[model samples]
Target: MEILDPQNTVLTNAEVYNIVVEKKKAFSSAPKDHRASPALRTVIYETLTYLSGSPAATQTEEQIKSLIRALSPYKFTGAEILQLINLRPKTAVEVQLVIEECEERLTEEQVNEIVEIVKQNFPIQSETKNSLEAAEG
Candidate 1:
């Protein structure tokens, strides 16, 4: 994919999940003469579970990519976009905190755009909603 960003980057948790799955497939299909490291495979599986959460049931990698595209105009880096996916920030203040390290400051409108995309793709459960509202209030 021709992402208008630096190399060696991922745009979302789903992309990371995809990488882990591909690695598992590669290790399993390796020639008998070429044994894969069990330790490394274990790490990949752990990371996948950590990054995926339960959102994998609803959001696909392509949907994550579409979210990234929607947010591209805000000029966030791929790493920042991935963080947005993982964090699923629902408010402008929350989104701002997540992207606080960015060199470019986003306007309130830009932040809202990101918040909208995240909410549309990764709807939070009622428990999470209550917690977020309590924290924000």
Candidate 2:
């Protein structure tokens, strides 16, 4: 396959998870003879399993877009924004860890604001959800 727009976009894990899920559904619905290879099927299954157990599973499009818009003023790098979405940090320390040079770039209040923004955009994953998943797993 040829590469088109090699750097057209940077996708968060949630977006990747959604895409993988769609591909998995398509693969399952295709004729057996026309289905993807065994290796591809294995990859899809493994990826789905991992993503389901991760924070990405709970992420939604609206949340992600809102988060990006809210955080744009901070001028964080794409990688940092992606990390923020994936980790859903709840504390200043966590925000500091994700954003490079936080000590210099982001004030204490800014860091705290980022934390609140993350919390507001992606609420903490509930313990009940985790427990239910653990039980199911």
The local distance difference test score of each candidate is 0.69, 0.87
Candidate topping lDDT: 2
Candidate 2 residue 129 C-alpha distance from true site, Å: 4.5
All candidates: CA RMSD (Å): 7.9, 4.4
Model 2, 18-99: lDDT tens per residue? 8889889998899999899999999999999998888788888889899999999999988999899998898899999999
| Clash pairs detected, candidate 2 | none
RMSD of 1: 7.9
Residue-level lDDT of model 1, residues 29-50, one tens digit each, is 8896675677886797788777
Clashes of each: 0, 0
Global CA lDDT computed for model 1: 0.69
